[model samples]
Target: MDKASVDYTLYLVTDSTMIPANKTFLDQVSQAIDNGVTLVQLREKSLLTLDFINRAKETLQLCRKKGIPLIINDRVDVALAVDADGVHVGQDDMPATLVRKLIGPDKILGLSCGIPLEMEKAIEEGVVDYVGFGAMFPTKTKKDIKLDRFGQGPIGIRRLLRTLEKHNSSSERKIKCVAIGGINQSNAAKVLYQLNTPTQKVDGLAVVSCIMAAPDAAKATKDLIQIIHTPAPWTQALTITKEEPQSLENKIKTVTAKSPLVHHITNGVVKNFSANVTLAIGASPIMSEFGDEYEEFASTIDNICLVLNIGTPSPEMMNLFKHALQTYNKYGRMILLDPVACGATQARLNVVKELLNYGQVNVIKGNIGEISGILKLTSTYKQANGNEEEVLMKGVDSIAQLNEDDIISTGKQVSKDFKVVVVISGPINYVIHQDRYKSIPGGHPLMGTVTGTGCSLGSTIGSFIGAQADGRNKDKFDVYEAVIGAVELYNKAGREAAEEAKGSGTFMVKFIDKLFENTHNI
Candidate 1:
């Protein structure tokens, strides 16, 4: 990939639910562009071939108008139908070499290369434009997959950078590589730094959930663009932007300053952990899910931040969620819905969509599998044969087991449709909401080793945003600031907690312990 072609150096990818069916997908893509989205991808995982072709054609026209390239995910036919700038595919979805053949030489072609071996494969193929790596951590978007192959450890990202460096390096084929899965506002800096390796790193970052999951979609896209354009220092100030805050990472400083209270009506597995993580991230947490009191709580709480996480949903719990959604929408409170287990089954994906469509969600967070499900639901692309079968995802974890480009392309599509933030959590968290995007560089793989961690992070961010609503932060930097505060706090605590604990159990305990500790930076 040529450096000049990638203007921002980092890009935001959306999922279908990130937009609504009743809305215009192209319009959503345009909104992100207005916000600073540099590149766009059309992913119609669910729509029929003809429908996907139509939608892609429509979206591609918009992207071209903005001078932003449109990359289609999974289907070469759709890309051709729309005259897309490129197509992104995984190992199983379509071979990179074959995709290049289909698109001809003028268009871009990206492959999913999470492990060093895959990077080698991409090199061997020679037709790939850029390579994507990770499910940085476990995410709600593509729940069932695990990111073992990337093998960065707590510094798995550094390892990924090193591995990518080994393959198609300027010393070799000179291909570009970007990180994906869970790359978001909070962790953008950390991810980029590691990629830079105290040295100029690969081409750029391809993001999903982080950007897609923010309230200010436009700001999210811009932030990520800033991170991509600004390389980190080799020595200190690991911050993505100047500490002055007015710089690109302005949203981040605004977020951590307020210890906002986030209210979550989510699953049992990670509630306490989420609360602790929130506190650590310089926010407060109020976990209340009683159906009867929800409306009352919604009314009384000054900071109305709600997280609808269906980690283990029951009919009754879902009903409560519906009620909560009603309360949130009525009050104009910030709401984030993690479509837990969305893609594993058709019924689940449909329900997730129902919840999102029914609710006024500020952001939608999930993994590749879940995002794919949303695309299948909203877009016209039929889930290609062997696509799901090839996917060996297990739960709502951001850690990836597939290619990175597929994840980012889907994330971008979702972000465009929803007209909100869409985040696909992975190693290098992509936090893109419009032009505002930030890629948090590094945390611990232990993040996923502990269950409910992803859910907790989402809940924590909602709470931080809630503080502004609660009148806790008179300054009220913005919703994106609150999210950054939440993510930073969670990561710092997780990194600290990782010190005392080796396994998941200990990490969970220490994570909570650190979240509650005041000695650390909020």
Candidate 2:
């Protein structure tokens, strides 16, 4: 069989120890093949050489009978003895070039790559037929394997997408990638969809215990195949619905009545403003940044919503943010990220990237410059001399030239990339969730004059999200509606405050009062 003709959709790497005591290893393999597994690799490390060769021959025959390719794992001698279709080697195993030379030209060779650089090396050397990219998630199957030696540890969906991006840009020949490690029916859809961008996607899913340890291997295989092919509910494009004024008012009433706890692990610079904004919008605010206290709030607080702001980040603060985000995600709660000045420094950008990559952020709220920085867009501004100066974000301020289409496109792309609602704040606020986007177009210029308004806005959104959770409206919570309502409410309060205030200082106070008044009236 030719390597190019192989169908790797559901690659199975056999671990006989994981099979049920009642079922033979061959029986499970046959059932999985009957269901939908497209490829198989016989991996036996503890068996004696002769015993391994015998098992390889038997497995190869079974696979050939089913017209499926069986590859040997880390045992080129056994693969040669059995004349197996291929051999898969790990990073520390026989080098791909040497393996190719030993196996000769017609036989297949699969190299396990943990990082993009290794993948690049494989393509550059032109030695392997395919690459196995993983451990995409923590796996008990390969618990003893030291992943750090390979320069990656469970490269999550985001990192996997990045590795694939690097590979596509550098190599002209298409190299098939089969994702291994911790892939199961529960997370197969996410591994397939979330790991994919508009341009890059994994060609197949490689499994160990998911099928090997299953009571019903056929059913497990069938179920995994189904999930891999079907679109996750969250990934589907939702249409924007026009929200009525009455509906918005009712949502506000729910917030006041419930007063859900909105936890802010924000910067010290904006902690007071964020907490006040949360309270004024009819939500209980808890300003806590200690990682030690995260478990208490995550466990005890009801209808909890977390706001993670990177306005003043330290390694300790970033660690706390990670803890909070993981806790919220574990409880299936909402988390809003305010990436303040993410593009200002390499440290800030790295911290934000780490948070986004690790956490399942539900909402990302930032100004044009911050959002552009997070998305890595080349944003520029007009200088006093009427020349375009590349915007190097200095503080938590937006000095970039604003283009409506560019902002909208960036918002949409970021939303899709993270599978999260993105709110880009400016003169026109864009609330984007998947395909649906709405622009809330009014805010007093005085709003920008106040410090931490952006952080406060994120806090306000967190309050609404918490309220929605309390109202038992999570499944029904319209992300676009919630964002639009938050922006509209804040904008209206700013406009009212501007009318009554003499200056930015007075406007800040009036704005808080207006928020309370609006909530009370609703």
Candidate with the greatest lDDT versus the true structure? 2
**TM-score for each candidate, following the candidate numbering:** 0.48, 0.71
Query: Candidate 2: where is the Cα deviation over 4 Å?
Result: 1-70, 83-85, 89-109, 113-130, 134-176, 180-193, 198-200, 203-247, 290-302, 377-391, 469-474
lDDT of 1 by residue, 1-522 (tens): 333366535566767666544445455566677777767766666899998887777777777777888888888887887677888887678777777778888888887755555666677767877777665545576554434422322134444555556553465546666767666654555465434543336466667655554555567777767755554321121112222333222333344544556778777777877776666655667878777777676676655578888878778887888888767654556778888877676556656755654455666777666666665533223323235433324655433355655656666656544544666666656555544555565458898776787787687567555654211234333444445445555566678888899798888878777766632442
In the range 306-327, model 2's lDDT, one tens digit per residue, is: 9888878887887788778767
Model 2, residue 505: C-alpha shift (Å): 2.9
lDDT (CA) for every model shown? 0.62, 0.76
* Model 1 per-residue lDDT at 112: 72
For model 1, the stretches where C-alpha displacement exceeds 4 angstroms are 1-259, 380-392, 397-403, 468-478, 516-522
Evaluated against the true structure, the overall lDDT of model 2 is 0.76
Name the top TM-score candidate: 2
